[model samples]
Target: MEILSTPQGDFELSRFPIRSKETLRAWDAADEYLIKVLHEEQLLTSDSNVLILNDSFGALSCSFSATRPVVVSDSFIAYQGLLENLQRNNIDQNNIEFRDSLREYGEVDQPYNLVLLKITKSLAQLEDQLHRIRPHIDKNTRIIASGMVKGIHNSTLQLFESIIGTTTTSLARKKARLIFSQFNPELTPPQNSYPKTYTLESTDYKILNHANVFSRERLDIGTRFLIENLPVSDHYQDIVDLGCGNGIVGLMAASANPAATINFVDESYMAVASAKENFTKAFPDREANFYATDCLKGILPSSCDLILNNPPFHQQNAIGDFIAVQMFKESFIALKPGGELWVIGNRHLGYHVKLKRLFGNCITVASNKKFVILKAIKN
Candidate 1:
């Protein structure tokens, strides 16, 4: 593996699930440009406490190791990548504190002199993160956020102005632009509103989308199909809803098998938070495990009897089956003997081959013209 050299240090990085040959690297040109600007400007100091947000793979954080930085991001995979990168390069993990998007930001009581922002597609989420960081900034604090040219928009600048202060973009470097902003004093943040409701004939489940959830609108079509055709289980006692966005699959499973305990897992804090809220609203009296995890990373092996997943095929701006493949492979490791893993995916993705490779047997349970639901049993 090639080491990514930055101002912080040189480190090796890889995509999650440990593919032998990944088409993409964790760091990008935008990351390099941001580090270049930071170095050229000498923006950070030993006394400077930095908050790095939306760092896709700890590139910004790892690059800025000169000043012990605190990293915050929405993606659980990003978080995993950061830690693994740090460990791979022999960077002291204790030097940086990693915070996920699910937790409250106010916990960082120390004032921040610098904040490195990485723009996400969700402007609402970016605004919320900025609003939460407001209380910790002083007038002289410098906030530098960057993203690919395609992600920067007028609304992106507007959100920065609303939460931080007036902003301006730098010239594009490697097709990326940086948004520079000053601290805004005496600004009142908008109310933190969440757990949005969406009513549909398929299910009356309330969507608990935080700032950075997937398809925060109505029900996603794949989820709708999975919910409509959920399998009936008579003997399964333990269940897992992998990538349980808004807890739809686990919610439905709970409703069908009232006696079965379900574990809802997703890497996104926003998704898990929303799932928790939906679980509370839908299964008010039921008890279950809801966690913001990187797939089944923290799950004990051979503990689950059944796993239902609508695995994501993409991460950030890239589209691929690496995530889904990892989830299936991980599910196989985490399931008990004879335990079954149920999944739904777009037919064009050819998830059947992936599952067959992992589970040794894959069966098509249901299908439509666009989607196919498959079930694979652990040996």
Candidate 2:
């Protein structure tokens, strides 16, 4: 396991759901660079309520948890990593504030003096987040956003100026650069009209997405397979669509099992938004529970009867099974006695072993050459 050592402490991080041969750890050079700059200038203090944006892993927040930092990120996997990493390193979570990007508008009541922004591939969505953050910004609020050199495009700088303030770039260290910006008191950013819509003919519904939803333009193939191979569960009282991107699996589940109450959960604000819209369009009369969460972290234990997942294999550029494993563990914890979890995944990923370990029983419900639908029954 690769440990990311920072000035604050050493963090042993991995891509969620552990992997046998994964090459990437949770922290990156950008994280190190960000921490370096923060320490170099003493930007972090005990009283500072730092809002960390887009921390891919808990690298930034975990190191600064002692400072009572509030972590705000758009990635479910990243949020998951933060919690697991905090646990893995034995860091008390009393000071941490985990805020999902989708529900960021909800946290406007809490004011933060300093914010740490880490730019990702979703720059367009980042712009919207910044705009929403305008009302929350004050004169003393300083933002330091960083990313790998490749992630820092000209438009990234332009978007910072458009939404936050004047920007300056730090020299690249290990191919990562930081964008330092001060809030512009004169500029007031407008509200973003998100939940972008796209219609799907197969399900015959129009999906709404917040900016961070995956494959917002069209459906992903893994989800299509899961929807096609959905199981008929007579005993399922409460069902959850884990990583319910765009709400496709959960929507299909609700359509098939109208009697069951479906809970749709995702980390992305856009994903939750899209799922809500799709649910309304697909089953307008039904009221379903939808949440933008970091995996199943906040879900009540031993509550759900069934969980459906099309687990993601990567968080950003790093490819691994850490996330899927975490989801499996969470599902097991959240499931009632004898409850079941259904999942569809690329066969190459071999999710069966993880399921077997967590649930004590694993079976191949259905399979194609490239993909397999696996089921785990909680014992």
**Reference-based TM-score of each model:** 0.91, 0.72
> Which stretches in model 2 have alpha-carbon errors above 4 Å?
1-4, 9-22, 75-77, 87-91, 104-111, 188-193, 202-204, 220-240, 260-273, 280-311, 320-379
- Give the TM-score (vs. native) of candidate 2: 0.72
- Candidate 1 lDDT by residue in tens digits, 241-322: 9998778788888888888888989888888888888888887888899887878988899999899999887786668887
Angstrom error at residue 15, model 1: 3.9
Candidate 2 residues 228-307, lDDT tens each?
88877678779999988788889888878878999999877667877887888788788889887767978899999989
Which of the numbered candidates is closest to the native, going by highest lDDT?
1
Clashing pairs in 2: 16-322, 16-323, 17-322, 17-323, 102-269, 208-274, 210-270
Q: Clashing pairs in model 1?
A: 8-63
Per candidate, the number of residue pairs that clash is 1, 7
